[model samples]
Target: MLQSRRRLRSRIFVSFALFGLALTSLFAAATIYMRARLEDQLINNTLQREVENFVQFKQAHPEPDAPWKLSTFDAQIYSARKFANVPFAWQRYGTGVYDIRDFDENGKLRPYKLAVYKDDRYWAFLRLDVSTQRLSERQLITALGFAVLIFAGLSMLIGRWLSSRVMSPVSDLARRLRSLRRTGQFEPLAPNFADDEVGELAAALDDYAQRLTELVQRDREFNADVSHELRTPLAVIATTTELLLNAPDLSDKMRDRLKRMERASRQSTELIEALLLLSRAERSGPIDGETTDIARVCADVIDANRPHLGGRPVEVSLRVESPLAVNAPSSVVAVALNNLIGNAIKYTPQGEVVVRVQDGRVLVEDTGPGIKAEDAEKLFQRGVRGEGAVGKGAGLGLAIVRRLCELYGWGVGLRPREGGGAVATLDFQPRR
Candidate 1:
């Protein structure tokens, strides 16, 4: 549809230009013809009048060398006719009877003839010459050429402007589609006038994007639910394996073997769950859930991780001052916050870990060696490192938090703390 629109616009522009050129050519030809016809008629009328006047003048004077002041029209016309090879002749043979014959130098009949009568007898004859009106033709053609040039220029400008106006929306749509192809996203449909074809295209693209977003969202939900469902069985297997390792009758060698097996089982279970959550987060669309207090969620997370941070001399501070709330599932929010606090506790050995609420966001900060620039970007990926400074970690803590944030439709990011260590934040849009 878009390509067709562009082609249509291009054709319109070309057609307009061609129409203008045709119009100009027609007008130029008409102008030239009219000018030449008018000039010919004027010159013919002037020549006839000049010939009649000269005959009358000669009859009144009756002498070839007679001196008479000629009128402006007579002087101009006669001089031009003379230079163009007009002919004159006179003959007298009887009383008061004289015959005159006028012919061109090449014996060609002239365009004009005149006879002078004196004493009831013809005494002299005159014939005026004719020449092609090349000068008049050239002037008319030049004027017509100028007019056509102006018209063609104006037509080109108008055509280009109108074409761009019609095609601009199509260009924008093409750019958007290209961008989507590159990034694997079809979002942010542009608005256009309903009366235009571009509007129809925009509406269609918007609909397609909406359907795609919904399908992706469904997949994300399915993955998240699958991860949660798998956790229970994994927990059972891990617990059973631990029991076998702790059997009293078993030999030391058998016990050691069982312990390794138990450890491996636990790790595998966590890894699987983490992988599922990561898949969910990467695929999910915007989150839609109940409005829950984010501050309260942060407080619960801090409390849950307190036992793990107990032995260390690390100080923990929490400031959930405002009525911070978010539009998200409470369970997902809880899970996200728990992972955040747990990561902070695991990384910080002796310094403070603070949970604060401000500007409608929940921030968990820990004092430890900050994440390296190289690792920071991948910190939220599945099975990626959550706590860079912490030596013993499965690197799924931040991954879980990232997935939960996606499910809840909140923005999450990691940044270096002002003093030291790193701060993970969940910036949520407040419920109205």
Candidate 2:
């Protein structure tokens, strides 16, 4: 639900950054590998040829003290004819180039490429010091590392700039969408964007918004008509019942029936008004200024729903722990409380239905078979009911309660109560 946790723009930018890092890192690694390979090849070929040339010269001169000058290379000659002249380590070698790291005559460890040339009479050895080559390799690595850093940083900056440009149209669409929703009107959005995915999405949204606006208008008008059409008859019924109750010889039974009829009429009128208000989804100015005594309304709701217990020995009671009031229509408050208290009474067969009114909330606790806490919220969805719910209920009472609470800026929730029961809470205070 918190969509801002990872945004599409962020993903795009990260992708660009990683691509740059990977490309540069791979190139630097390849450069280091190739440089090492070529340097090794050049040194091996040069040393092999020079050592073979030294053997040919030794065969021709055949002198122990001869001027043997060469480039940055060292040479040593051994007579294979005499087994004692060659060192035990060098005697094992054939005519080839080999890598060796060993102590020199001065007892200092050095790494070199060794070229050996041998025949029936001479064993020639040529070597090159690679310490300077190793230093060059180190300097190359450092330079490549710095190059990677500079390019990677530049890529990240480019990624940020590209992300902003790419997301500008989407951000504009969101801003315009919020504005249209606030004004309760929508216009074509496709015309404002290019012919791409964004344009396609805009076109789809425009169609949906137009349909939604029409549907809302029809619903509000229908609710208004229903309230208007139903009020007149409900009013007539109340008036007729009142006039009849005052007749000369009305029996106790007849008066009781008439009183019930009058109460039902009043209840119906209040329900219509509340439903109409909810359909409008607005404050209507009246409810926002009217301070309704919610404690009194809860008491009335408890009384009205008390008869739901039927012949059961259940006790239905309202406890006013403190006076409560809300800036909302009395009808809306009555409808919400009626559903809550009525459900509590209907569910609790034998124990108790308690409506507790506090400073800013109402709690309807009932001693019935409790539901799972996880299932409590699902009960408020339309056409959803408690498991194994018996009798004639469309399962919309709690749904209506939730809708009215939302419309009035209130909060309603249900949870399992301790000691085997369910608790329904209706909060009238505004959310922080």
Candidate 3:
């Protein structure tokens, strides 16, 4: 978009420049042509008048033997045979009208309009010095050239100014849109803008923002209501399952089924809490004043999942280098970490799962048929499961983990372990 605007401004400037150039060039050419024509006419008229006056003076004086001298009308006379002092170019011309340029006695080039007259006795030639008129014409041409240059420069500046004025509102609109992304709030456009296309666009943007805000508000309210309503049934199921598991003389089969129900209920409650937190994070931000000990969280997650281990012969251990602390909601951290550890446990048929907290990262490593290269990234997407996935799942575990990480500015990644299986690492420093 920005590149397109720049091109638009450039096109406007070039158009103005070309227009100015063409107009100025046409005017300059016309001015120069008229000046040249007028100069020629004035010189020709002066030369003709001088030739007539010289002829009259000669006829009245009748001094054929007298030496040639400069005339009163800023001209010089020469006889046809007196070729000693005449210029070579003038001597070569026949008895016809001729315009010639030659150096004067002072070694400065000057224009001459020549006329020749023939009589029964001798031939008389008249030359008029038209250097002044030629100089004036040259000066006029130079001035016109300068005027064209000045006008062209001015046109360029005017084009630039006009483009800036035309694009100011658009640039402002773009800046406001960028700010809206950062702050999640719409800032009304200034009311003083001209009542034209830009003003209409600003009004349209404001209307869109209002409608979008209302839609987002409705969605947030709906998510909150749904999450709240789901908790009641989940709580009842969990409570009922716990009571059934503790019933005296309960059949083994019934107890096992109750345990599965309890686990499913717990998973549902966790998912609902995660969704609620995510919705809240979107509406406002990460919850404030919430912190968790990384080591304790990992230990609790591992212990909670031990019941599912049942006779899998998988060893789960937690290792903490120090008391690593994170400044984030415990539920957010728990959901992220539990997904990692739970996947590790669920995928590993008979190997060890190690949870380590070090260097501001929680590393969960497991020994299982390692993930396919293509599935490494796909695993984090909703409804995407790895090729080696074991248990039945909606494929929301890693997606939820990814969402929580993004909401709180944490980092999560999964990679294959060197020997075999996969390793998941969650970086918590960004949240802090």
Candidate 4:
């Protein structure tokens, strides 16, 4: 049911997003068209108003149509013309009057703007220039700008609303399901105020919760079955070891063999302990919220490994900024630093291992031969070895370190230090 709801949500989200995009495009195109029409109307109305004003002004003062010979007038029209011939674009042309010019598709005159004046009289004469290219372009640009801003704002609003309307219940249900996993209680579904896909999602999640409960019950039984099977062998091994050690009389060779057997048993126990620690480290969830000083953890790890240094001269440098803090468990951090320092000591024959905290990171540098490029990828894997590593200890130290950092969402990296040798760096987020 949860999977079905997820599929449904994906479809709804895509549809709503596409709807917003389509509306935005349509709005932009419509605004452009409207702006063009509005500019054309404005030009026409201005021409008519200007022409009427000129006519009214001419009537208030008297100007009789009489014979007038002007340089721009023809002989036949000059006797009837009463005003000077004026050239104004986008207006009608006649003798002793202003005219406008326009472009026409069929080779015919198209009036672009009005130029008004009375015949043989100067009465409030004015030219009204209309360049469709200029005014229309400005109007179109302004409308387009407004459309873009409005559509962008609306798109954001609609997109957010749709997402919440469609997916908020699914998100809530997922949280509830997670809660059920962490705790065994199966609480009733929360109220879904929405009446769309979100409501359906909430109902589907309730069904999912029921199935999860059944699966968990089966898993518990399975775990018990496996644990019972493994317990028999472990008990036999422990009992047999006790019997062997309790035996009193024994030859030197037999005692030595027994001693070796005990050593092997002890090593096995240590390996198991390490494995359990590693598993716990891997299963560890996100870091704890408590603030911890990483500098102190590094110091503790360095101090602990000092005994194992075998008198090999090793220099420890602590370059941490005072009070280095992070929201993590001190033990987890200590483990990571312990592994790094241990490796540094293990790999280096006899040299200083510089431990420094710089830029919110702990770096362990050793003068040992740096890891090869091919081996670097495999270094963090369990039981894997680089070119020069010796010994039979399972290579789980670095692997454990990596898993711990991953569980805590910290960063760990290895690189060759300048001059010689390799450097292992662990970057952790510092507390604000």
Q: Judging by TM-score against the true structure, name the best candidate.
A: 3
Estimated TM-score for each candidate: 0.47, 0.65, 0.67, 0.40
Where does model 4 exceed 4 Å of error?
Answer: 1-163, 173-236, 273-377, 382-432
For residues 1-432, what per-residue lDDT tens digits would candidate 4 score against the true structure? 233334555768686878767886789678757866886777676666567755665677556763233211122222124324433331244434444554544576543444343355342333334454456668777877887787778778877877775665567767876887798777766353244465556667677766876886776676555445554555566567667767887677776666555544443443343344454444432254567788877776676666566677767566675457777656567667777887887777767788887767888899887776566658899888666777768888888877777777778878877777889988886353
For residues 1-432, what per-residue lDDT tens digits would candidate 3 score against the true structure?
222333444656776777678767767677768677777876676677668867877887888875444442234356646655665666666677678776776798878888766544445577877666776777777867776787678777767776776577678778878988999767776463445565677788888888988998998889878977998899999988888787899988888778767767876776677788787766222357656888987886887788778799899999887678888656667778888998888888898999999978889999988886667888999999888776688998899899888887788988989999999999977554
Hey, what RMSD does candidate 1 come out at? 14.3
Q: Candidates sorted by TM-score, descending order?
A: 3, 2, 1, 4
lDDT of each: 0.65, 0.79, 0.76, 0.64
lDDT of 2 by residue, 144-247 (tens): 67766876787777777767766766888898899987986677887887665566788899898789878978987888788779998999999999999999
- Model 4 Cα RMSD, Å? 12.1
User: Candidate 2: lDDT of 119?
Assistant: 91
Q: Which stretches of candidate 3 lie over 4 Å from their true place?
A: 1-101, 109-130, 164-207, 234-270, 283-290, 430-432
Clashes of 4: 9
Could you tell me the C-alpha RMSD of candidate 3 in Å? 7.6
Query: Measured by TM-score, how close is model 1 to the native structure?
Result: 0.47
lDDT of 3: 0.76
Worst 10 residues of 1 by lDDT: 72-81
Model 1, 238-345: lDDT tens digits are 788778866779998887666656645544554564456466444322256447777776765676567677599899888866677665555566667777787788
- State the local distance difference test value for candidate 1: 0.65
Cα error of candidate 3 at position 71, Å:
7.3
Q: Which candidate, 2 or 3, would have the higher lDDT against the true structure?
A: 2
What is the Å distance of residue 430 in model 2 from its true position? 11
